[model samples]
Target: MGIKSFQGPRQKQTVEEIPLRVSDYMTKKLITFYSDQTIEEVISALIKHRISGGPVVNDKYELIGMISEGDCVKHISESRYHNSPMQDMRVKDRMIANVETIDGNMNIFDAANKFLSAKRRRFPIVENGRLVGQISQMDILKATIKLKSQNW
Candidate 1:
């Protein structure tokens, strides 16, 4: 006796191409601060740009550390408690020296995973040890949305 094979309906599979690199979604126009800059000045720039924090670069635009609102708050608290002037505080003293950075060529998915694991809201995108741009959680979300909206 011969058995007949059953055939199911053929389904079309679509593959979506996503922008793979962090550089694709990173913001090139960055608001960076210097280590020697006063905490007050850094806070002013952050408020003016409406940013939570930024990367601290040296004279050669090399990433050294990061300064954030949390750092500024700490400075404020210390100054208030000690009755010291906030103007004397510098970014280098308040900024995190061991900064975590990402490369521009890093995959977006990898960057997203890193963001999920870390408490940081953004990551500085560096190339050749130089600060080129910055990538945030929102940037990854925006890129994903754009990729999903594309016609397959």
Candidate 2:
């Protein structure tokens, strides 16, 4: 017979439930940089993570801007071939402000719609007014393709 009830004391995990939302599908362990972090550090971070860009967060964990590979390339070009003092440049001085972002609770349709309508390929998922995770065009496309193939 299937044991219907537990005779011993039940155990519970201390972890809380994160509301299943677009945020849930996002990459939780985000690789981010600070405004005061050097350009070298930023470039190294992007290369190390194999990502195109990341959000720049402050001490309060609030998203202030984003730095992409494109931004770095443009920065280098604008410097007139000057050798950047590795110790001088900071993320804030080179980051793209007014970046596009979305909430985690939004669905894939919304994410896709944003990508199509807004012309933005990546999304920083936020929760409680704080940066939580990131989702990119690749992630969305992968999800779409995977789901479509499942029934085929």
Candidate 3:
């Protein structure tokens, strides 16, 4: 008899597709601060909201700058050495004026790339020159984990 070939079951792998957008993953419940707000108030707000920092907005809700824990640290250190109180320090004095913003329609992959290329932990999502939401590195990580789980 001729040699017999063994037949094995063929398995078809299924691919999972997940299209993620910044708006879908962004934190809609934003805790923003005003430029005129005192550093003491900003610090209290940050602690109350359990956030490292947030965008500084104007009366029209336009993103004017960004205030972060790092900025606060600088002010605190200087105030300690100068024997000055931080209560009078305004958010605008320590806020980063040159703010970089992202659009809500941006893809998660693109947002990941942007995070890799920058030192920012979060980006404010803006639409029509107004603050809409915020996206953080944690958000991107969660989206990636969700995508991986869907494949399993």
lDDT of each: 0.90, 0.78, 0.90
Q: Which stretches of candidate 3 lie over 4 Å from their true place?
A: 1-17
RMSD of each: 4.9, 8.8, 4.0
Over 1-152, each residue of candidate 1 has an lDDT whose tens digit, in order, gives 99988888888987755677899999999999999999999989989999999999999999999999999999999899999999998898999989898888898889999998997799998888899999999999988887776642
Clashing pairs in 1: none
C-alpha TM-scores of all predictions: 0.85, 0.76, 0.85
Residue-level lDDT tens digits of model 3 in 27-117: 9888899988999998888888888999999999999999998899899999999999889899989999999988888999899999989
lDDT of 2 by residue, 4-112 (tens): 8767987886755433346546788888889988887888888888988898998888888888988877776766578655457788898988888887778776788
What would the TM-score be for candidate 3 when compared with the true structure?
Answer: 0.85
The 10-residue segment of model 1 with minimum total lDDT is 143-152
